[model samples]
Target chain A: MIRSKIPLRTLAVLASPALLLPVAAADDYRDYRAEAMAMVKRDFQAKGIAGLDRLEQDGVQAVCNRTGNHPPADVVRRLEQDQMASVRFPADGKLMGDWKEGEKLAQNGRGFTWTDKPGLPVGGNCYNCHQISPKEGSYGTVGPSLYLFGKKRGYGEDIQKYVYSKIYNAKAYNLCSEMPRFGYIGALQEQQIRHLVALLLDPESPVNQ
Target chain B: MRARFILAATAGIALAMPVLAQTGASADFQKFRDVMEEDNPAELFEARGEAYWKTPSGPKHASLEQCDLGLGPGVVAGAYVQMPRYFADVDKVMDAESRVVHCMVTLQGLTYEAVTRQPFSNQSGTPAHVNVVTYVAGQSRNMPIAVPQRHPKEREMYQIGKEIFNFRAGPYDFACATCHGTDGKRIRMQDLPNLTRPEGAIKAVQGWPGYRMTGGLMLTSQWRMNDCFRQQRFPEPKYLSDTVTAILTYQAVNAKGQIYRGPGIKR
Candidate 1:
């Protein structure tokens, strides 16, 4: 429907060429994250795809949020272990998919907003945080560039499994990662993650070029 | 193979800013803003709102001449800059929109829902409240923003608003902080001010009740808050909700000393 998230989507659309005079909302500089959570839950509604359940932080979100995305090492280790346990890998041994499809998913940032029609495909929005392919001129710096994923890391089945699992649940690897848990949250499927893995690891993929 | 694809995907995310002289789009937007400021269609709303305020037409067949903007009855001048204040009669803090709806209900004999219905403007028609907002906001143009916090409720609202501003939620995991809390960030050519800090918040807040060039709609602070949340993928806030007012108070108070300079012209 793309109707529910009118506010957020409008801002997102406008920001592309929008000029709201750029204002920052202000400080979590102090750790009042718990207080913020209560107010966040109270103020915002959970309509359609954006249910109140999303507001309820899982263990990963809880640890990351409570500490302003900086949970202690021991806590991160335990939580990361728990998150890893939640990743449901494909039943079949196959873990690779089309890099072309993966590139489309990585490029798409639509989905998860309350307005998005349910069951429609969601995108990884990878470029919003990383520079995956050199061909693209604009990419975000929120995450490190993966311009040569397979080239730098070496192409191996071990690498493929790691990439697959990582996309499934980034928190499993980094407790407070700014990246979303695409597979863990069901935003992406096994096939989709396979494609994304290929997007990075496939030697023929532009990313490796 | 990778070389040609990035060109098509270059527009994927709207990040970064270039100055007016630096880029074609920025230069165009700057020109549009300047032209609109010289002759803003938003001023028409102000004129209509003034008429709506003075002319008696509600079920009560009375005017909003008795409406108090925390500056006594019917005092529109310089009243907007101090909005999102605690109203004793309603027992809550209200921004300009809330105050207008309150008057429409109390004096005009309109139902709360009727007044709030069609709260935002589209290509077709402007909302009744928007006209009143434009009128009220125009009256305070060039005045310094001095949103009050003397009342306990008002103070509470400000604190709540600050928290709301920081509270992150939704699919993309965006809080207002995701895009706005940081400095030197942009979603395309538009500059993002750090609302957490007084300096940044003032510049951003100062522009609302503005005339949007893209749609030629006059937007208010209420609309601003509403739109921001929509983009956050949160549920639509009720018209004049405490949460809405609280967020306004937070932005307003941060912008206390800046000259209230709207119904502004915006890209």
Candidate 2:
């Protein structure tokens, strides 16, 4: 009876002071990010959904990590073009999907954790870093609030394309942007990016409201 | 798919509900933390650990009486804060856990493989190495934090640690900075330590080898690192590996003057 009443995951969230740690490393102001990656490659092994290849930074990550996320203008211009060239748009040329599905994907933060089942579907985790739908009360502040993404940015074809490409490869627009190259790595599929595009660019979407 | 959907819905509402709940929940959590600290259960582990340190129970039938924790032999006090230090015997930098394993092998004649197993804890109480490490950390409470960086290898460890702290990988592309790195950021109600600054770094690293109240367990920095990597979605680091000490060196040097206050309780 107790087992029936209780959830299986009652233990996962228990006493998690690991993240609540208040310590930060001082800016030794050293270029150790590359060496750190080498150490990680040697120190860590692959398990489940997470693998060794994840340690291998793409061109964008290599440049960003090396420069402390602050590259020179010339470097940024060249790299941004390189990143933007990587986005593969849908063959159909349509750039919108169901907003309701988009809302679900944006709200969901489950995916790609080592504990997660391999090859299972992943969530967008958008709310972990951005505000998407206005109704979703809790949103992270790592990025600018996107509650009026469509309204403020102007919901146009170019806007739709911009939103689509940005979500696909954020570094494509701004070199060394903290946002992951979501579309660049296929973390989200073509349709999923389209759905996310709708969530951000559709006037009817709660993000616009 | 259905389970995922249901879980997503549950998570959505859970994240959504807090704005309405406001500050009341936070106050209750704070009160709960205060009560938990009023009497730390980690002391039990410390007691058992103290016994393990003194009592002879190895192939050599020896106690760790002569084991040097960078504070000479058998001097437990203030040794933990200066750990992850370079030891001439092994010719490498080691954190508290690795140093214990080294002592266990040479002083007590235990096998490295057994003492350095994958998971630090078991279904049965705490592992021998973990208990000893936990006890040692308890001895250094209130001592000023001072992990050594004199040796070239020690300095190398610190540099490597800086990178690992910011190393972002895996499917989600999350790194330590994904949650931390900002001045004031939190996941839900939990505070995310900005591990790049002194004030934040001291509070984050000092209070480990802590007791987790919900699970009724004593945790070493090794276990804490293991849990963090798991949460960060990376495979586990081998126990007492160079990677582990490197990370510790980075944290310790940052919190150089902050008084240690751990073997503390966690909510």
Candidate lDDT (C-alpha), each:
0.74, 0.74
Candidate 2, B44-97: lDDT as tens digits: 888888999999988999999899998798988888999889998789888888
What are the per-residue Cα lDDT tens digits for candidate 1 across A1-209? 21131233222333342222233466423323445556556666667666665565444444444455665566666667766887888898788899999899888877766677888578788887678888875566556789999999988999998999998878789866666777766788888899999999999999999
**Number of the top TM-score candidate:** 2
Write the residue-wise lDDT of candidate 1 on B1-267 in tens digits.
453344323422222344322244434554456555757888888999999989998899999889999999989999999997888888888888889989999998999888777888888888887898899999998898888889977877777777667665455455676667776554434556778777878876776788887878888777888777776766666567777877778877987788877688776
For model 2 the local lDDT of residue B177 reads 69
Candidate 1: misplaced stretches above 4 Å?
A1-46, A138-154, A157-159, B1-32, B187-192, B213-215, B265-267
Instruction: For model 1, report DockQ.
Output: 0.21
Q: What is the lDDT of residue A200 in candidate 1?
A: 96
TM-score of 1: 0.79
